[model samples]
Target: MTTTHATGTREEWLVARLKLLAVEKEFTRRGDELVQQRQALPWVRIDKAYRFDTEQGSVSLADLFRGRSQLLVYHFMFGPDYKAGCPSCSSIADGFDGIAVHLANHDVTLTAVSRAPLEKLLAYRQRMGWTFPWASSAGSDFNFDFNISFTEAQQRDGEVEYNYLRGRHAMDATPAPEPVVQFAANCGTDAQTYARDRPGMSAFVLEDGAVYHTYSTYARGVDGIWGMYQWLDRAPKGRNETGVWWKRHDEYARG
Candidate 1:
């Protein structure tokens, strides 16, 4: 088949591959440095009592740790009004089941927290066939305090702050982006309700019987943990994106 991409002899390919290898190695080293910097950030002690509803019943934030000293919470975007979880968040979470076991054994409990009711979260989890821990922050300030979920008042007053930026998210746009509208409809809600809940991840540590917020990242900062994107980045065509081209796992048609 004729191809538009560059093609060359084996010798030329090897030369190019070797040069790319050097650049990849440097990128790896830079990523290592970032790891150190992330860990070095000051930990803020959480004094507010945040509770979550789990299969075990309502529990404190510390209980979500599952007796582990470290906790990693994926701020899933499943608002109370939505009929289903966000497609983007669902895509990111598709990888959780595979890694949850390894993370648990490593003394880190990975849990997903969302504003949706426990019943809703559990039903969706069953639909997705995910076994990872999921907790409900419905009627709780946990999601709001972590800055992952917002209220109608906050959205109306333009007080929503996300990814360390104020009033700049595409989801918060006046007319709502096409992707946001599409995703919102897929979740059985409107764009405004869907955008109120943003996706992110947060890390916490239990020290001296107290919990401290270690770090949190939002928006593209979460790309590192979205397993599919990592593989796509290494693929021949890379992301090869025009727009929102993915759906929830079960929504995809089988060949």
Candidate 2:
């Protein structure tokens, strides 16, 4: 049983909606300004020749641009020890393959970077049936350098640096929370193993034959790319979340 809202007459509803429309318009305009601000940020040159294991074999970070001037890497939470990707990250990736072609045509190459071994990544990619390019950062410092994946020692030190902050992660709890434990079990790993890996996205630009890191964002910053959340956010009831209520796309029960 849910509570109901007050009923309004047509005239009253119209007046209220018009007022809300003004606010919506202001929000959209602010969003446009933020986009420009992001573009204006400083770009850092990447000197290290970071290599990744891709379907096309070992390739440098610049190679990921794939002839495009820009590259976007979704830092997926699939660490070396986890048997599968984090469910939340998987949910966001579910929408990627659909938009990848459009991005490629627009001179932007969007891909997923994970710390899992190439074999594991390929197997899961096959299971998910995603055609978008995914590369492995295994045996590389790409994930660490980007500030997403953390080492066990970092976790034990009670200062897991993530989302641009150095602090104790929730997964650092001795037993962790029930949801974290369950998600780890789903990934065929323990809570600590799952908690150590965090999600993030990074942007790079290829200019004058050099790779420059343009931007990086984590946590809620990625909400916009999680297709399901974008839609759910617009629904009347909103996200309506209480706890971990999502799984890998195929894990849902079929009608």
Q: What are the RMSDs of all candidates, in order?
A: 0.9, 1.5
Scored by Cα lDDT, where does model 2 land? 0.91
- What lDDT does the true structure give each of the candidates? 0.94, 0.91
TM-score of each: 0.98, 0.96
How many backbone clashes does every candidate have?
0, 0
Report clash pairs, candidate 2. Answer: none
Per-residue lDDT, model 1, residue 7, is 97
Consecutive 10-residue window with the lowest summed lDDT within model 1: 164-173
lDDT of model 2, residue 41 = 96
Local accuracy of candidate 1 as per-residue lDDT tens digits, 1-255: 899999999999999999999999999999999999999999999999888899999999999999999999999999999999999999999999899999999999999999999999999999999999999998898888888988888888888888887775678888999999999999999999999999999999998889999999999999999999999999999999999999999989998
Error of 2 at 42 (Å): 0.5
